[model samples]
Target: MSHPSMDDMNLNAPHSMGTTIIGVTYDGGVVLGADSRTSTGVYVANRCSDKITQLTDNVYVCRSGSAADSQVVSDYVRHFLHQHTIQLGQPATVKVAANLIRLLSYGNKNMLQTGLIVGGWDKYEGGKIYGVPLGGTVIEAPFAIGGSGSSYLYGFFDQAWREGMTKDEAEKLVVKAVSLAIARDGASGGVVRTVVINSEGVKRNFYAGDTLPLWHEELEPQNSLLDILAAGGDGPAPMNE
Candidate 1:
């Protein structure tokens, strides 16, 4: 058997979003959230790549998996949706957008590598969330999560997700979930970004890393090392810790 060359392996490696993306429905609207890490194998290609993509005025998608595949899917979906809206003379509903994604994902399952969560508010349905995972399966969910960090979050969501939550509560949950995942999952990191869509309009929020709540050992002080080092003298220049 001929072993693959290093160049062959490098060329075939996909740029992936080993991510934490979420779609949550609240009392009045839906919120989509995601971490911003894009990686190629073990190397981080982009520290802050926006995984949440806007599909229309209200509809948005949280993309996870091969970055290129997800981007191309989103782009195609966006164009199709634009035509859909023009023909209908109204904004496309959340279901329409999700189904389009499902069609593309499923039809090209053999060639594509991506999992998407679609979330938005429609005049008819009020608020909705859909999970389109690998192989083109579409599942409507109250709240949907995907990507590498999702394994760590299944239990967390079971305990934390509830019906009729207020908008603020849902947003808080998303931020907290991403932060917890960041602490545990090596592939998910960077800031958290969220999109809220409702009867009124769409709103976007950005949370910096420093502002997020620390979890587990992250909350513990590293004072032991710093204090020991400082014990001798002036202490390296009083590091940030």
Candidate 2:
């Protein structure tokens, strides 16, 4: 059998999607983070895409995989959860929403190719994190992550993740994990964006790329590439809003 070439691979699977998204459950609530850069294969598609979305006043969802698929599934879950809450006068919990996604994906034969983590605080559950990947499998874990950027996470998360962390500790851990992932993953860059779900409700925050430590700031270029292209261009600076 002949192996496929890069050209064939790109042609046969013409979509490019990249991201780093994580969800963590701590003592009081759940924390979620996602990178802002949207990529298609090796090319950057958008620099300002928000992978973490508000599902409700207390619930948040982070998506990774095909942008279109993630968008549609997340929207569907959001709408479904919203209507369910309004109808019953009760907010949905992280597990409820995760299982809902699992149901929808299973019915669709898990065609979306998306990995999602639903995080939130529920009056009944306090704090929770749910992971759903392709195939409708729903996992209730203390922490969960997804995307190509996850390739760099094996050892990183094992060391960084811990239970009973305070809100502050969880937030900083999120920042560190995302920062390291961005530094190493060529397809995952741009500023790190996050959402925190607690009793106060879901709140979003961000870390501009410039605000993060430049791991390569001390490396001297063998010759110079910055001098050849755009003299002063640092190439894709972080955006502020």
- Cα lDDT tens digits, model 2, 1-241, are 9987756546434344477888988899989998888765555667668889887778888888877777888789889998999999988887788888888877775467778888889998888898887777889999998887888986888998888999889989888888778878876777888888888877789887768766654332232464445676565566998
What lDDT does candidate 2 reach at residue 234? Answer: 62
Give per-residue lDDT, candidate 2, residue 150: 85
Question: Pairing residues by index, what is the TM-score of model 2?
Answer: 0.83
Model 1: which residue pairs collide? none
Q: On residues 104-203, what C-alpha lDDT tens digit does candidate 1 reach at each position?
A: 9999999999999999999999999999999999999999999999999999999999999999999999999999998899999888999999999999
Q: How far does residue 182 in candidate 2 sit from its true spot (Å)?
A: 0.9
For candidate 2, give the lDDT of residue 215. Answer: 65
Per-residue lDDT of 172 in model 2: 90
The worst-scoring run of ten residues by lDDT in candidate 2 lies at 218-227
Point out where model 2 deviates above 4 Å.
1-15, 216-241
Maximum-lDDT candidate: 1
The C-alpha local distance difference test score for the whole of candidate 2 amounts to: 0.80
How many clashes show up in model 1? 0
